[model samples]
Target: LPSQVSDAYEKILSRSKDQSWTRIILQIILAATRPLTLDEANVALALAIRKNEPESHSKLKLELWLGKNFKSTVMNLCGLFVSVYDSKLSFIHQTAREFLTDSEPEGTWKGSFNMAQSHHPLLQSCIFYLSFPDIDVFHPPFDLIDDIDGRIKSYGSTEYPFLVYAAKNWPLHFVSQNAADANAFRIQARTLCSATGHQRDVWAPYYFEEYPNSTFDDWKVWPDLTLASYLGLYEAVEDILSKEKPNVNLATEIGRTPLASAITQGHESVVKLLLDNGANMKEQENDGRPPLSLAVWIGQEAVVEVLLKEGANIDAQDRYGWTALSLAARSGQEAAVELLLNNGADIEAKDRFGMTPLSLAACSGQEAVVKLLLKKGADIEAQDFEGQTPLSLAAGYGKWANLWTMLRGFVAIVKLLLEEGAAMETQDHSGQTPLSLATEKGHTAIIELLLNKGKESKLSLSQSISA
Candidate 1:
């Protein structure tokens, strides 16, 4: 099946009147994280050919080359190997991508397709597209346009259709291929980094436009190294480090170091490289979160191991006083929780709310973490500042609210807490018992369980009295 698919792909390429352009389009589609819209693909192709020109000139040249009927032309050129659905380009089948990317074709196409190598051209196109003149005008200080969304929509509609994709995805393409040794690639990367104004202008609008509710205030203080680290560009980090040692510990407005960026992004290699270059393992963010805590919360197990082996503080608390174990348990990061516990993390560490690992795990409906904490002898009757015990927390009491579907998790956790001799009559600061809390939340199963257990306890007590 794959051989036949590969053969068809080769024939499609072999028969192309413009083999280079067709291959570039196909490769762009193959490497794209999602299907590219017609506008995005058209702009991508334009950038591939006229990358050195201004954005306007590139569009003009593209229009001239492909004509107004470019959609049909592109489809006809790609032929049976590709398809267009709702104006988004993709391969005809999933196997086409798997076969082409997994290995080379059998005959004339042998040794031709390298999935990683194919990203090189797309990378070039994206960087060049980002580098176009006046591209940074959409960002702050220069962004005089009051109607930001309207302006962005208008610009994208009339000009630079691929700006958002290029701004956001350049790093993925940059890191996908081995462009480290290539001096041109290095220069291009550095040039983009050095153009801080241009960088923010292009990058921020794309981000804010996509996520309308997110704040961009703290984003202004991001240094080049921080951005590179956040983007997980390993080669860019190496290049920046080797050129001149920028402060590895230098933090952003939010106190996120390059190490923090790498850690949160799950870039283990970048994290290690930053660490070797004197990235502080103990450097806490503004919130007092250490590298280990960040790794644990983010569920970067390998990065968590890296930070631990390098001597990250196991019990360092953030401003909320939550330690790595506390975060892991709450987040249901069972592996990270186990790792921290094995490394001597305090099992009874309290957050600002005086919630223990068990309390948090139970409150968050983390069945696995709750079970693990129980096995590790977590305090079943541990009370928070609100006087809510683990059983009370598992009963869906206090600030925590369980969805109807998630109540099953609460039920299981309640069962575990009860099996461990958790006191059902323990009242929170609100004077609510576990059974009462369950009843308040309409958790009928948990209410019934508590009532049955109460009866069992009373029956055992009466029998002992009779004896």
Candidate 2:
């Protein structure tokens, strides 16, 4: 017999011939990279279901379709295998996802669901949905939603669920399309650009909210070549560069060049193209991370190597005085740490907080990195701005949300720290010792390891520190 999960998915897909709402909802959710809120799903379904139909003629039809009972309908149809988590609808199990996406040799019509190319249609929908009336009010630059008269004057329709989703997810869908498809897709995308705010204004609020790291107000000000370069759209990048001269060093609002963006994304071809076209390798964002530092921070080994080969400053520091080596060690990126060390990185380099690379690696439970640092003769008793040693930092980690995962790795980390001659009695600015911090967090494994290491540990009088 087939598994229970497979049976459930088969049953759902089989209902597609019946043209049920369940199939439509599932298609939308499965195609989406991000989870859809219930409100987003309801509004989106209205547009998705009427895709091939003529435009609407009545408010009553629209109202009925976007009814309050949409959630109940989904629950009734697929509650066994689907549920909302954190306000976004998603499949209940990994088996359900695998069954839906992966096809068999003798697949039926329902199993032939085209998931890889799913984003193409969704991209079309987003462009169409944003083209509707009253979307400008949501754009905020127009300030049309500020007053009652402005709302009435500007808005023809104001149900915002579909608008909210379309505004945030258009780029996600576009990026997934192939070069030929993406280039053709830009026809509709560029059509919207002629509208007020150059099309970006409609999506700006949601974009800022979703991508808080984005430093620019509107990427339209930057050439399409710049964005294509950042997204690793190799064909599009070549096409754009062929048409235009090299703007490889062109920057966005916060001084983030195309090279920095590509390095941050680990886009190798794009980085090489920008580099070949004379892009500056040392460009930093407004937040102060140079291209090399960004690569190391995210553990992009190949990109880091390329930057290093291209003569990037191996020891570049951000505004916070954090070096690439320190960032790699603290993030537990072993390959990056090894590469940096092999290239002559400062193993004990301290940041503004006075926390060395070794201390951070041990505190973050990076066993391999800690061993590597110790082998390189990193200071065992180095302290931070708060005078917390590597042992104290490891003990402080008990207060983290991932206590179990950290605790599991940290037991070993603590053993290494002790063996490497880490000072257990070292106190932080709060006057608490490493032993006191571990005891407070109830890390019996680390506590036992500390005691068994044959060191006379002492606790401060108050013992208020924790990981």
Candidate 3:
């Protein structure tokens, strides 16, 4: 029964190619008499017509078959059959018939539009254009018509074909095969426009609508502006800024200024443009850290020099009260630290916790920064709030290399402190003198350096310990 039922339809449709409509009709009757449902017979007949059989009266025959039942199934099949043949009238008629047949009076024929609108706007647009003729399908729904119109108006001129296709056939717009092809076309069109600077009006509209509230200060719009600035289209950015300037002080949602964004992204031209336009160089983000700090933190020496030349505050402190010099020094940025110090940044500036730049450099084992800070008059004996001096910080943290380097470069600092009547045996808040710290951290070289001084003083343990 399954073979007869299945093969019967195939056999009946196969006759259409040979112009065997009469035989097809006879077979349909015989198959129906075999206890198949009327819908089954109609499906068989519809399949026969769908094969593009060379029959002269194929449409007429399909019409006759559909008329027998005229229910939802028949209308559904008719809609599908018409879609395959590009028969718009037949598709609409069947869809309308299904809508009228449903018990719900408010049901309207929305074969593909309904399905397309449920998807992403891009995909929905693709499907609607491919499956339907135009946006006129849902006429009675004035609001839907307006919605579709608004969406269509948003696309570029190059996207007209796709919009047309989407507004028409919801199924075709959503159909993967057709939708991909249409998307390819849209991408190609956009590429051509970008390449040739063509249809600026079309491209400008979408950009303006999307970024109406954007500004030069908004890091979010920085990329777009960077691109435009790279292209030398100062006018484009000017037009946008004329509409509204973003909060000039507003840090990026991710904690960067538009200027920082441009610099970090390597948009030199955009950075120059922004700087010329008065983009703030002293604006701090990521916990109140300035742009110069970020450049130094990321080892961007060139950006640091630029900011410094533009009058960026070299001594600006972050939330931790760490200055640009401290950050650069701790990160082993010798050149950046040198630049900051040359620009009047204090080498001995302490952070919120009272850890000076030299102490931070020594703590991080940045020998070069330690040497530079020492050479620039950093008070080698300066103590933190914890009473830990630079040497004590390096020794306590087990930074032997940094301690050795600091001692070698500033050995006279030790001699000077001793000569100036400094307390070599003074203990920090932790009850550890610089010598004790060096001993605890096992800095043999530093220990030797300190012991030689201790021996030279010849003050016995009682005098040295009491001092």
Q: Which predicted model would earn the best TM-score?
A: 1
* Ranking 1 against 3 by TM-score, winner: 1
Residue 364, model 3, lDDT: 73
For candidate 2, write residues 77-105 as lDDT tens digits.
56655787776788777666666566662
Worst 10 residues of 1 by lDDT: 397-406
Computed on alpha carbons, the lDDT of every model, listed in order, comes to 0.77, 0.68, 0.51
* Ranking, lDDT, top scorer first: 1, 2, 3
List clashing residue pairs in candidate 2. Answer: 396-467
Estimate the TM-score of every prediction: 0.84, 0.62, 0.45
lDDT for model 1 = 0.77
lDDT, residue 149, candidate 1: 64
The Cα RMSD in angstroms, rounded to one decimal, for candidate 3 relative to the true structure is: 21.1
For model 1, state the Cα shift of residue 437 in Å: 4.5
